[model samples]
Target: MTESPAHTLFSFGTLMDERVQTALFGRAVPTSPASLAGYTTRPLQITDPAVIAASGLDVHLILERRLGASVEGAVLHLTDRELAAADAYEVDDYTRRRVVLTSGESTWAYLDAKPLRPAERIVVVGDSIAYGRCDPQGGWAARLAAAHIAGNEARRRVFNLAIPGSTLADVSEQTPALLPARRPDTLLVAAGINDSAVPVGAGDGDVRPDPAHVDAGLDSLAATALRHGARLVVAGPTWLDEDRTRDYEGLRFTRARALALRASLRCWCEANHIDYLDMWEPLRGNGGLLADGLHPTAEGHRELYRHVRAVSC
Candidate 1:
């Protein structure tokens, strides 16, 4: 009598343990050294008592996609019954996936059951600061996009639609163009700096943006975003160097006005249950953060990128 055909299983971690094989299959299944392409291993915490006892370790390896990366493992040839037993041993966090190996062989392996979906698209709209006027890297939004959406290493697509000298009203105007024919993913607004600018030669009561108008603009943006299925994030304005800004291009930017706008934006975001990034404190008083009193330096842009990624991304 001839033996039945076998299923191929690729394992980079716990499944390769002889002790685990014996506990699950009653014998050590034969394995051949192999490598999985386009994936790298990450540590996963295992809580199943049986799995821990069988492998004698509480952590296991799972695969995540990384271009040009590879996971070293082995292929096990198992009979139908043994394969079924192997399936029973895996935890819920892992799901079997078909993959091509480095040696031009196809096989099955367990991967993260709930893998993170790559962000489809991200859109940024705001003022000159958002336009990355001074930062060599184009600003915080650009840096974040470059890290996530550029080249083969990219996991998503990012678009910066910010225009210099734009206000919250400008963002509202730009919103229509942002609505995707399909579905929109995320929209980040980084305005209010231009709005807060105090005209150097104007009267005491003349601030550039009317608070009421700012609120209306924000409301319009939020409503449009909700209707379009896009997640809205409002990144508040940072502080300016009052001394230097007092004479820049015949416009005076005051820290006091920036503070007030930041507070107002934060309140608006809170009232609407929206995400708001407060960038004032982190960038304030840092001599090197601001270039020419209004725009952020490269390091400042990096800082903004970090904070934006922490919440918005």
Candidate 2:
């Protein structure tokens, strides 16, 4: 693990935004009122939608070096990983510089410095199961994050991109664009169950996906991770109860599709040396594990979180 950062950073821009802070630091950054001499804050319009969505503003505060001017802001301490995430979050227009504060404390401040550093950030992408769509406490993803805090596992932090009803196609089509913005150190993807719900196989009436779909989608996902310099962890689809999905209308067929998706995912992960989690191996035949025959119950989320906890982000 990288050493925790001892450097304190002064924020004069979007880093002050709570959403941006959480996205970068994985926790609320501790801050205190501080001022910088010889600088002034200027409001600038940010055109990047990703930045706007994250910071919830189309305008950002920037510091301009000026004589006899003092800029008031907050002082914050961030881990090395958090610093890297912040660097990635800011656009190219900004740079980093060390400055002395009015309070006699010197800290790192973003100005216009060049950016590049290692990161330990993670993003979770998947459907309702990954989103904990039914669980009030936010399901397994939240639990996994909580576990990290309890264990002092600073090597990994998460940003959830999961959406209810998202399919592998959605992941393949959308993740490439989102990853660069999040710039996660790793991407843990849980999908394919919804895709398998579609018809497939040569039997009388099948709705499962063709193996080609899985292959193509996985290929795209893998490539997206590579493009962002992120490692990929592919988790198999969650186990399901037939009673919840159309009262076992096509139980065997759905099961087969799930199996095929898992098999293909397993093979791909193994061949690529990527980490893979098996929802089936752990939850199969476990009664009441699900909330609606589809999503996992809260207790079930705890179980899933335990599994996610094992993987090194």
Candidate 3:
């Protein structure tokens, strides 16, 4: 099996913009002409401000036809960083997926698939962030759900059982009630911010529910999800914006505490063969999306949706 470049994109569109290529990759990349079998392309409107500014265009190609013909494009070599940047630039109109070119080359391409027609029963179990509290429109979950529905019109039932201040234990406690056992759902969890909190007086040394206990709870959550015949995924707790958290929300946990908790939660997910998304890295330093450094604002929810798409969809 051949490994794809850390990143690869078969661009039938956008990267065609010189400014977009420059802004997204910092330089023009060498490309080879390629054609993808079984797809058709049409114009897709670009709505993201930054993407519009970078591309200097409001429309790009959207591929819909998936059989009997081909779509001509180019194979672009992108650094992982650049690939992520391109993902951000594409916004939600398109999603990247691997494709095999007629020339026998395998690469990635952006496609606007169909929409919702529920196939998998996906259940999200965790905290307030999962509930999209501060995100005016909807949290990442909502955004991801909409996109999932669009991608194939695949009908999906996503049970969002998120609670404010939910510790891993709280999540474990709620699992049986929210998730169906025999039917089996695709379960996702994002908790631990509550357990990792240092509080105003506790400083950063230790948290309320022991971190070990948090891990134990996470383990239990995964076990229960699997026992009930559901697939499990997790978005580990994100890092905080100290100033925003302190000034706005008045929550004062340190970076060290966040890192420690993230490490613990991530380790548990990896060990259990659970699909995981590291929430902190993507959301960090992003201002407009964060309402108070801790929770996502409306735009933040959209941004989270993008990240969620890359990992889950």
Cα-based RMSD of candidate 1: 13.9
Clashes of 3: 18
Q: Residue by residue across 19-88, what tens digits does model 1's lDDT show?
A: 8888898888899999976677778899999888889989887776554567898999888888888888
For model 3, residues 1-313, the per-residue Cα lDDT tens digits are: 6324476688887786666788787788767788876556777777878877887778877765443558887888877778888887777756564456777665667755321111245677777888888866658887776765566564344656778778788888878776654243456787877676664755454533465796789778766765554446677776577666763245465666777788877777666545567788677777666777788788777777777666555
Q: Which run of 10 residues does model 3 get worst, by summed lDDT?
A: 111-120
> Judged by lDDT against the true structure, how good is candidate 2?
0.71
TM-score of 1: 0.59
The TM-scores, one per candidate, come to 0.59, 0.56, 0.58
On TM-score, the stronger of 1 and 2 is 1
Give the best candidate by TM-score: 1
List residue ranges in candidate 2 displaced over 4 A: 1-119, 149-156, 199-208, 247-253, 311-313
Per-residue CA lDDT of candidate 2, range 111-156, in tens? 5321111124668899888898878999988887665444445444
Q: Superposing every Cα of model 2 onto the true structure, what RMSD results?
A: 16.9
Clashes of 2: 13
User: Which 10-residue span in candidate 2 carries the lowest summed lDDT?
Assistant: 111-120
